[model samples]
Target: MLRPRKFKELETKLGHRFKDPGLLERALTHASVRGGKIARFDNERLEFIGDRVLGLAIAEILNQQYPEASEGELARRYNRLVRGEACAKVARNIGLGAHLILSESEADSGGRDKTTILADAAEALLGAVFIDVGFEKARAVVRKLWQEQSEPVPEVAVDAKSALQEWAQGQGLALPKYTVVSRKGPDHAPRFTAEVIIAGRAPAQGEGASKRIAEQAAATALLTREGEGGRLGDA
Candidate 1:
């Protein structure tokens, strides 16, 4: 059995106590260590419920905070915010990784630092909180946990064209150029087909609702091809 002192410390930090601390213990336990023992429930089911709770809480937060933003914009921010990397970052910030119980083999393989595991554990903890109390209490807990740390998400320029151009620049290669292969549809919403041509290789083609977006898609395809061939320059 896990000790109460550590859980008490965690509750102090989190500003809430579990009526049933076993839920939290289960949330921290990984399947790698637990083999269907009655006392050893893994956090997978908790992760599933927590995922929904997280999405709803984040959506409500975004909707309330950014009333004028389009749903697409809100969705983009939400996705970036709730992604594995983001969740792992939060887990690290809260020192949740320290509490995880994994098998010796898994721990030897660096399970403590694994982003996927950390993120899953964080979600499971949220679910545990939800189960221990209710949605309103869960929301309060989440808000308190995240509010001080939350900041506006920076926009990622991860589109293909930018990646390709960066790759070219890093390799001292010639810049890529994009040309429209075809265009169709109404003036207000045209579909553009673009071809991205690298200096020494075959051009890659992509289509999007806009020329810039299509060019970016094409650039991404070209980068993917180069990556597969082991030709992309060092990051």
Candidate 2:
């Protein structure tokens, strides 16, 4: 049996008590540790269930928070909130990585800090909570942790590429350029990596499910970097 003290610390962070602490333990177990066959117990099943749980909670929140917004607007906001990167951010905020129980080999390979792993585990944790308690309790946890953290959704939802273009023009600079760095994953859900280059500045990269989305991600990355003191060339 896993130690009670370990789960106690995690419960404190999660803001919920688990009658079956084993549920939380299972939620934190990685498939890599189980040799990819989770017959014993792993986060995979929980991650699956949690994905739907998370989506529903976020949809409900967005619907309530942006009452007058169009369906398209709500969809955009929903996508931003439920993306893997966003989930990983929430996991980091709650220090979920510290409680993960990885095989020695997995931990040595830097599994603890991997964004995909953390995001999956975060979802699994939510799933475990839903299973242990119920939808409403899990939802309350999600709302408290996630509701106030998202950047305000724009009314029209401009793509990142257009936003960056307008910004560069306002600064009297040449238009920014984007390049497809790589494409990987299966055909059904390929991942695209894009790099955005600006005059006299280091390139910033981003990844997404499509070239256009990747380009938008790249532009957003560059803009965020520049906003955080990564300078751009003057007019």
Candidate 3:
């Protein structure tokens, strides 16, 4: 059967023709679009399964690709690859934003471009594919999409927060302070917004599912700005 125009385009981008396009459609449907209560119809259930599917696929790849790496190293690399930012980046690369089905309010509020939503949708897609096909095909898709980031594992994968602290200490600056700017979403999946303030530097803001992730994002943002130029940091 011919698919809808949007799903056709999405399938092309994903490089996987779906036998059941309904799976893809449901995966792209956000909770906000479905009144936040359609447990069986929304993407949240798919997202939950997809998270596991993604984790397993990544683990298999990491194990095979870097046989010499230790468990700790593999764990770090896996964390980086499976993080919300990583998923969001893949979603953007595949132009998944344009295919999302969000409520009018969500669309008006820029839900299509939100990191969390995009990431969740990406995971849901993976889950849908896993269910539609088999593990091997899902593995192939993961391998293709995540190839760029599948380089050899580093000896030490210092998190952004740790790296930022080390940089600050190296510059003889006081330790950066992180404040929770806002918290939203359901209890199961709360979104936290954090702002990090460095002495003599302007604050940078980031959002994530937890306080730790938000702080790390904020620190990473600050570090990225500093690396780009002296102005963004100063501002």
Candidate 1: global Cα-lDDT? 0.77
Instruction: Identify the superior model by TM-score, candidate 2 or candidate 3.
Output: 3
- By TM-score, rank the candidates, best first: 3, 2, 1
Tens-digit lDDT track of model 1 for 76-126: 567656768777877887788778989899999999989999999888888
Tell me the TM-score of each prediction against the true structure.
0.65, 0.68, 0.69
Each prediction's RMSD to truth: 14.3, 11.0, 10.2
In terms of TM-score, which candidate is strongest? Answer: 3
Candidate 3: list runs displaced more than 4 Å: 153-157, 160-235
The residue-by-residue lDDT of candidate 2 on 1-235, one tens digit each, is 5657878888887889898888899999998778757455998899998999999999999888888876646755776688788899999998889889899998999888999999999999999999999999899888877866654554544567656765676677788898999999999989999999989778999999998789987898888887922322221
For residues 1-235, write the lDDT of model 3, one tens digit per residue: 6688888888887779899988998999999867646577889999998899899999998999888876645766787799899999999999999999999999999999999999999999998999999777877788888778776644555677656765676678898899999999999999999999989889999999999999988988998888932322321
Ordered by lDDT, highest first, the candidates read 3, 2, 1
Span of ten consecutive residues with least summed lDDT in model 3: 226-235
Q: Report how far residue 83 has shifted in candidate 3, in Å.
A: 0.4
Off by over 4 Å in 1: 1-3, 36-40, 152-219, 222-235
Total backbone clashes of candidate 2, pairs 3 or more residues apart or in separate chains: 0
